[model samples]
Target: MTSTNKESNGSPSPSDSSKGLWRNLQFARMFIAYALATFGDWFDALAIQVMVAYRWGADPLIIALIPVCMAVPGILLGSVAGTLADRFHKVRIMLLCDVITVVLTIAILFAPNAIWLLPLLTLRAMMGVFHIPAQQALTRQVVSEEHLFQASSLNGFVAQCSKVAGPLLGAVILAVFSPQFCIVINACTRLISGLVLWPLRKLVQPKQWEGKGLTGQTRTETESVLTQWVRGWSFIRSRRIILTTMLFGCFGLLAILMIDYQFTTLFRAIKPGNESLLGWLASSVGAGAVVVILLLNRLPQIGYGWGLGGGFSFIGIGIAALGWVTPLTPEIWVIVWGLCIGIGNGLSMVTMNYLLQKETPPAFVGRVFGIQNSLSSIVLVVAPLVGGILIRSAGPSPAFQYIGMATFMIGIVGIVLQRVLWAEKKSPVAALQE
Candidate 1:
């Protein structure tokens, strides 16, 4: 067989350059399934937002609650979910989550009104709590370690592509059909994705926990949920680099959340009554992210330190610039800001996550990632409410200015902390080399 044909048939192992693009048929199936599922998620978000705003006449903060519902579960259940991911067959867990999410989506179709959305959204979020870690763990299982960065980048790319497409499709669907109909379509998409994953059972091996001996150990001492949860924290504390990286992530997410909220509000101000413009702004961000992914794919040897710091610096400067440009005439400057944030977000996400994955021990991967997700969710939960209040009290421009300043300060702090940590460690490059 030709080399290409051998690779296609899962016979020839992939080289680093082709790792992300040349997944085996089984991995390709899972990738497509994940892409479709993510599309369904974004579709649901767009449909639900429009339904809540136009039909229910909900206030902006109230509308924000929809995302809050989605994020809260990830924050609360993340560690436990990570533990479970390490303990169970990850693919089976993912399949189960997809099924549950599909059921929840269908339930939303029959939801009487916006009020009914809360409960359904809660269920969907809970499913995500199970889905995300399992999905991450499974990706590690299917790919070689050298390919992990590529796999992660490709995953981010697909997610960004969905963000670009799903809302626009939902908008077209909403114009032609009801939001309930969009929900139905989402349910169908999720159902098909779930079915596609169901047959991949052989790909998911049981975790190392199954091999551990604790025959005479008490449940509390051996397999307690509390112990499992604490184990994640303990793992973090033992690794100085991991702890430092997580701290950076926490501050970075806090700044990112502030920027995200302010940018959405700024978009409204810049193009009053033009919701499609907001969609375009979002698409611009996704487009920027796609560019970052493509660039990183070509330059695999670059370290995370420069990418993380530089990306945050760009985001900070872009956010600050938005405050200055909002008063200008053309109004397209908002799009430029959107593009900057998008590229910055994309680059930062990939590099930071790659660093974490590379540095973290395989046994603790789920827990570390879970903690990162929880930190981001916690920031998401708090930022919007506080941002709204700040805007109400001090107007949009000042709120954005404050956000930019805060983000900049945080970036500076991250840089300083990295320097200090490096200085303290005798071998600075060792921590980052991972």
Candidate 2:
């Protein structure tokens, strides 16, 4: 691990050996490609929603079901996908998925109606189920353990940039063109990601059978895909800290992701019949994340506990204030609150991801991330429906307030958990795992 020093102001500074994380040529290529892909996805999503709203006049439930449909494949097949990432070359999996995305994204363009697009969207989600674990595992391979947090921050930075760039771009294109144009842009982005990543095939190192023989391995190696998936699950079950963190993080996100399902309605509450404003407001959240990612090196030295707990707290405070804001209030304040939520979201997500990569056995990193996806799938499935119902019954404001309160309370619990479950001293696996 490269040893880090402090800047004059006392913030953790990138080590000379690691200072070039963002400047690393290999990573820069991958990150840019990944960001382009993400930007396309977000833009496509917004374009689809706009299409649905205009073409079909989708109700709240219909709006909510989009994300739910997207989550279904991850719930059912995420573990299997994780196991596959471990079994195969991760870079190949990513390239293959990106290729698949090019084909699948085009299908959305051909959808004659909004109803036809749902299934195509679900197919794209299925590709994501495979792409995510591979992406996480590959990220672990590219950077050093000491620089993991920084690497994760860079990744989040790209993601946040997408969130900012995507919708705003979508809004502009949608104004001039149709949903088909957005879909074409998404398909082209995938092709671009593939072209960018194709040259990096030599960069991703292959897994070594460190202690295993070519032909002496057990029958389990030759077993069915189901058997391999069970192995992935068994690995996660043996890692209690990773498991616990996954559960807690998912539970916390369950409270927060409601925002995604209800965001369209909530944004509309601020200014009805306006779509471009929604893009700008959505960009505000990403703008917050972009700030954090850019200045990530200057953030104070903090333990995983403080990082995670603080993130939760920020998100809670932001959402609560977001709910409390009225139409009479200035819209800038709403953007401010949304930015808070995005910052918290980026911090906790990236920190926990760093912890997971640092602690997990290299062999099982793919599977663990897969199981993490499954847990998130569960939250995504339930939260959207519940959030949509809350918006329908109690209205978006109260829903945001109540749900944000729940997250705020969870943040408090996370703080306590940080003290009790995590160590006063460091341990490699989730801060306390042995």
On residues 237-292, what C-alpha lDDT tens digit does candidate 2 reach at each position?
A: 66566766787798788888777757778768866755665656567777877776
**Model 2 misplaced stretches (Cα beyond 4 Å):** 1-19, 22-24, 55-64, 202-224, 263-280, 297-302, 391-396, 424-434
The ten-residue window of minimal lDDT in model 1 covers 209-218
Give each prediction's root-mean-square deviation over alpha carbons: 5.0, 6.3
Each prediction's total of clashing residue pairs, residues at least 3 apart in sequence or on different chains, is 0, 0
Reference-based TM-score of each model:
0.85, 0.84
Per-residue lDDT tens digits of candidate 1, residues 1-434? 44334223312245533645464555676788898899988886778887889987888867767887888888888888887876666778888898888888888877777678887898898888778777776665555556667767878788888888888888899999988888888899888888888767655352332322112121233566566667768767866767777777677777667657565577667556666666666777888888888777666544555567666766776677777655444657667877887887787788777776665544456666777778778888887677678778887767777777777676666565665542233222233233
Q: Rate the local accuracy (lDDT) of all candidates.
A: 0.70, 0.74
Q: Which regions of candidate 1 deviate over 4 angstroms? A: 1-21, 56-62, 204-222, 267-277, 412-434
Q: What TM-score does prediction 2 earn? A: 0.84
Candidate 1 — which pairs collide? none
